[model samples]
Target: MKEILPRQIESLMNILGTIPGIGAKTAERISFHIITSKDNMVQKLIDVLYDIKENIKICSECGMISDTDPCHICLSPERNREILCVVEKPTDVITIEKTGEYNGLYHVLWGVISPLEGIGPSDINISKLIERIRNLGIKEVFFALDPDSEGETTMAFIASKLRDIEGLNITTIARGIPLGGNIEYSDMYTLSRAIRFRTRLNDNL
Candidate 1:
């Protein structure tokens, strides 16, 4: 059958709809706007879309996205190297950073242990974390993972695995974040309070 709308327009809308927050109607609107926009704007978008893959890379030290080996935070002398904050995703690091409550180094796990999903420690960046803790003089480690089963498991796994480290304090953020909620979706105030009131993992949980 012949298509009612232009084939190219339909194709553009289909692709746009694949983006996480964009729905069908929003994708349609975006496609129309992009088509009507200045060629320079479209070309600029295209350039960056292509450039991100080449320019962006995972930080070798912290597993965060960066153009440098040890991201800016890891390299910065201003941050407290004695404490390390471990989070599930790179976005969580941003969420916690916005709170301004933590002034320490960060380690992005990149993922969690989801058994049904077949994702285990080997799949995530846990080995890198151990190496960092061993090499760096981090006195305390904070777990800022989500409240789901996967998050709990991941946090426990890390803590137990690092038990051999001497003089290390492993703790977790308080229950300010509701169950089933992730750090990325939490508000600034709640996240800040959680960080401020953090406690040892085994003591409270």
Candidate 2:
């Protein structure tokens, strides 16, 4: 068969296919749509991409991506200072925020500990969390990591490390989140219930 798509469009599709969930067919369709769409629409997308790259900054306190260093959540006086919610990624922070059941501070770990993958406690954002809990006088630490073996192992490891922290409580969201399910992909209702019914990490471990 004769070559259907131009080399440039093929290259674009290949680039798009690199995205996590975008398959080759979807990438090809998106490439075609981008080429066929209005020039201003394409320009707008390009501008927005540039804007994101230039304006987005990682929050120093919570590790969430935002336009500011500390992020609005970290700066907000209304948030509960005595509790902190720890999650595996910034997207999980956004997902939990949508549930509106939590008003505490957050700490994004960026990734979970996976021995097979060579990720360990030192590899993710653990030290800062420990420092925050101790220095900030946070009374409770709520974990909202993905419900999987890696998540469980990570939580247990962190809990063990935090055992020396006097007068501190460690907890995790309820099991309403299905096993192997991701907090970022969970429904708001399930996440809400999970937060509302959270249990002590010691009890589950």
Clashes of each: 0, 0
Estimate, for each residue in 43-108, the C-alpha lDDT of model 1 and write its tens digit.
888899889978888888998988888799999999999999998888998889999999999999
Q: Write the per-residue lDDT of candidate 2 for residues 9-72, one digit (tens) a residue.
A: 8888889999999998899889878888877667888899999999999987888999988899
Pairs in clash, predicted candidate 1? none
How many backbone clashes are present in model 2? 0
Question: Which 10-residue window of candidate 1 scores lowest in summed lDDT?
Answer: 196-205
Where does candidate 2 have its weakest 10-residue lDDT segment? 1-10
TM-score of each: 0.91, 0.93
lDDT of each: 0.88, 0.89
